[model samples]
Target: MARDTGPGLARGSTARGRGATRSPGWALAVILTLICVVAGLVPGRPGTVALAVPFALLALSGRDHRTGARSGTEPLVLISTDRHLTRSTSTLRLLLTPRPKEEPTKTLAAPSLVAITLAAPGCPADGLVLQADEECPLVADIPVSGEIAVLSYGSAGVSADVVRPTDFVQAPPVRVSVLPQVGPTLARPVSRRLSGLSGSHTSRRPGEGGELRSIAPMQPGDQQRRIDWRATARRSTDQDMLMVRRTFADAEASVVLVVDRANDLPASTEDWFAAGTSTLGQGSLHVARTAAATVAASYLAAGDRVGLDDLSGTRRPLRSAAGSRQLEQIRTRLAGMSVVPRRRHRRDPVPPQGAVVIIFSAFLDEEPARLLRLWHAQGHPVIGVDCVPVLQRTESSRAQDQTVRLTLLRRRLLLEDLQTEGITVLSGSVQDEPGRQSEREHGAPLPDAAGTDLDTGLRLLARQSRRGAGLSAAPGTARGIR
Candidate 1:
């Protein structure tokens, strides 16, 4: 987070009537000149010099007036220790006032304010949590102080005590919410199916054998000794009864969602073609967030662990695990991720084994392909979600030619390549329905195949019991499992 700390003047030239007014001194000079001419004191060199004196003074006054007007309108920024300023010492303050208001006895409060506070080393950093008193206008300060930053929402009064001469770090507040439509699908299984599996069996009786039901007559191959003699004698018929064994698929699975944040796409039509065909959405980080959230929620509801690996900055991978608590941790990590440029690493770290590797990235280059290959080779199910349509068409260009065709072609190539490498590829535009392209592409028969590869792909996906598998593997092309 970077704060703007330079001079506060608005850029570009000011329009007429929008700038400082003419100085009062100029008016006074005109009045004095009138008086001098009317008095007729020699009306020669002395009169000329006398008139010039007032004009000279007016010119200086005009300059000062302009300077004062500019300064007075500037914002007065204050970084406070707390919202109420009850305690705490570390603070900074800067005052800016408009030139026109310099002469007036007026107090200026900033219409908008931004503040950032950094925690001292070893202090417990809580991150950017905002709290405000009932009387306060806006309480946008984040309490986590490792390198805390805050900005006023829209145009709001800002006051704080932490203004230093140096620049301060600022970060946007973390926003977390279940995607309304997909949330229920991700959450239902966790609370219902998983909970039932963990609970004790419901068939137990109240008293006998510590709530265990009475055993009936033994059948062939049944263990003979444990059969309740009294119950079997009463029945007078052959039967077999034993404790039912419950299977819990509620065991959690861990998934590592790898997102590539590197911006390496070209700037021309070729670049657009390249992006249009990739699995990840044109390598845009925002698309990555959406896809990651969707996948993370799905696995989380299944009682499967989820972790994040930001392919930006340092590749300090967030490990995966499932539980209500671990899910919260994953959400927090995802919320805090910031998109950054790619780093240069001659040697990339190997992805961890046994975890489902769901990579959300635009497969613009060979790097992501290599990573997916490595994960698949290690016996982990690797699913690559392609996010196409990085650019939005305007109303005027709604009927643009060739753009849509080229986009589809590139996407198809990308998906085919990935499929050949054994990585499951899913592709689709963010604005369209989720599974349309996957169904279409997977439904079509492969060239020279006896039946459609689409059917075989569906069977493979059905066997896995997870949606969004078995599609052509290429960059920038098709929409797969969402």
Candidate 2:
């Protein structure tokens, strides 16, 4: 994006200044001349008055011709990037356009030096490389990390001996959002009530598809192309009996990612009550966005429809659709989600019939649980992803530690209740500790001591679906919860 920072004249003023305002050198010259004249009158030094003449000439020569000239036009900075992947190196192209003068004689000369500053979480001070030009728009490729990058420009310095006074205007800073990196491809959560459109997953009903169902006696309406010659030869049936092959219909599944943006907490319990705590690299919202994006990409790649819904906002839900564009839309919405407090709790969004509903939330309260039960009752395969960051016990008082324990206990109980109701629960939380290098590098969950990660949790969810036959099972009847 290109932007005109602002309009202002900030001239260089020093002892050598001229025009209406006399320079400090001129004042000093006048003061010394008066002292010399006083000395000549008192000590009979006749030539002292002549010594003041050189000082007067020195002040007269320090003249400024462009006192009323305007400041140089502000340079426009344009920022463009090819991709926005998290936990990875991405290049930011910065195009610097030189200031344009509306009137050549009215404006001051261009800035002599330019300074570029790049700011982001954990960004180095010497990250920016400057190569500015007076005519052409200078382009510099900046490597950035983390979620957000802020680029700013300003005047480094200016020469005082120029014919006309000049000031370099600082460009307005530009902020670019780096999207969270997507994890490994996941098994698209199959919905029991698949849509009629042809897709990767096999439907329960027999149709012209890939997966084999069964071979049966051919009916009058059965297509001749579907005749199973091998099955007909194997079966010792009546004369002229023919067999036909049957297969399940190919159908697509709709996945709606319901994200809760009410609370964004850090991993450590110590920072919970502190204001302006740095959640760099470790935040609940970060995990939720990453998980949502990864799941959306995997499902869309498998020819499934994916949609997004924000629980804490009042905007219209993104409808389910299939394509690369759908994934981009979901990622954009997820990247923009932030903690919005005091929001009126609206009615839960209803997903398409039989769509797998995955809700990402910290689940600090009962709101998310209530929605999970609601979708479960509606015969939708619901999965609740706990997005609360992993609890880190820091050097705090005993009371604070106890409070942390109690909060964790309460969350565990809530998740258990949801699981008991046949809603699959998965942990999408990540640790913020710097020691967890693997977690930081992968941007995905690492297996715990119990060998449970996001992939393991999802595999368990698939197993549960198979055991209960998702839609065929009665609501709240599947007791084998993991």
Candidate 3:
């Protein structure tokens, strides 16, 4: 930004800076020179001083013809950053642009020394430096780590910027936007129909995949090239008959993350922040995002297209996209995701045909379960991942607590309804802390999440889905950010 210092000259303050300082000696000398001239000009002036007094005093003054003819006292230094904002550890290029010098003039400053100092948060003393006669366009790496990395420059013994110079400025602070980073994922994938692409899944009805399915007697319409002579010879019963080989077709599958943002019992922002050090017990939104990203990463890494949508429908849905670049875009979008309040205008988007839709949710009600049924009815393979962490009873009367128990029982019954509709409720090993685990004694009792860890739950689902049947609705696990 440009700050108007005076007429014609403007000071560029990138972020923040203080006013300039002027030396007292220069002002005192100029005043004395004026006094000396006035005294000599008087007709009845003291006979002690004649015409020689005025010119002699002026010569001794700080202001000189050489200095006045110049624009400034010395070459003004301009400090600036390459970018106004950046993230952690990102390379920062600071440009120290000094006004061109015609010839070095003798000032109180020592030309042999060019002192450089920097003031910034999370910054060490060694940010950037310039030699006595260093050239321009120099590269300096600033080591930074924090939410905001401030930057300021200082030039010791340089009188040019001391007296309200307009050329000097402090660069703006760098804002670090550190989002959650997702790591490698573990997901067992399956695709029913094999198409043109070669992939891991074996298609049910196939023409050309390398994985062998079965060998059969050749019919009249069978291709002669597909004949398996060895199979015919091995089986005496079929020795006289021509045997043909059948193989599963290779095909790529698409996955859609059907994130359920309609959780009635989500962790409060205060509760989420209160357990700052707890790795497993973050907010529900965080768990949902992580689960969605995990599934996306697994499928994408397997060379499959992935898409994302919100049950709340507050934001525009992302269509199915392929390739490595899409992963970064997906991660960034997930990081900016917020817990949107339920809206009546929410519309249910349809998943692609033959695509696998993984729903991340906490089944507080039957609505999310009913949504799964719709996807299943449309011939899409659906998997439900319950992102609910272990629940703790709130303060209430016995009658109110009984109502909570009935609500939970109804929720469990709805889960069974999902299974009857062919959805696998993935029961994961989720629990409150050892101390909080016993809180269930004060509240409604719940079935133990059957598994050693969260991975065990996911692994169970992966195994169950291997048969290509409907699967998923597992309890939440503590799979850390990655």
lDDT score, candidate 1, position 203 = 14
Report the lDDT tens digits of candidate 3 across residue range 1-482.
97667744433231222332333444544555566557756655654245445544544543422222223334344555555445235455555665455666574332333445565543455444445455344234432111223344554332332221123233343333223445456654443532345554545555776657789988887789989988888864736888899875656667788777664243332232232222223445556666666667776776677888877788887888777777776776776665566566545677777777777776766667877888878777677776655555552466655665665577677776787877755532134566345655554356322123334545665555553343221222111100
State residue 249's C-alpha deviation in candidate 2, in Å: 1.9
How high is each candidate's TM-score? Answer: 0.45, 0.68, 0.51
Model 1, 121-147: lDDT tens digits are 223333222221211222332321112
| lDDT value, candidate 3, whole model | 0.54
lDDT of 2 by residue, 1-482 (tens): 96554442223443224433444555676678788878887888879877877765654543443332333345423343323322234445444444443455432344344444444434444333243344222232322112343455553322232222233345556555666668887755577678875987767778977767889999988999999988898893554889899887778878899998888767666887667554354677887888888889888987888989988765678999999999888887777676776257545577898788899888888988998999888888888888766545562888876676677667777877876876777877543356456444644233221123466677666666657654332221111122
Error of 3 at 293 (Å): 1.3
CA displacement after TM-score superposition, residue 26 of candidate 1 (Å):
12
- Model 1: residues with Cα > 4 Å off, grouped in runs: 1-75, 78-250, 264-283, 313-315, 390-411, 433-482
- TM-score of candidate 3 relative to the true fold: 0.51
Cα deviation at 370, candidate 2, in Å, is: 2.0
lDDT of residue 127 for candidate 3? 42
Of the two candidates 1 and 3, the one with more favorable lDDT, higher being better, is 3
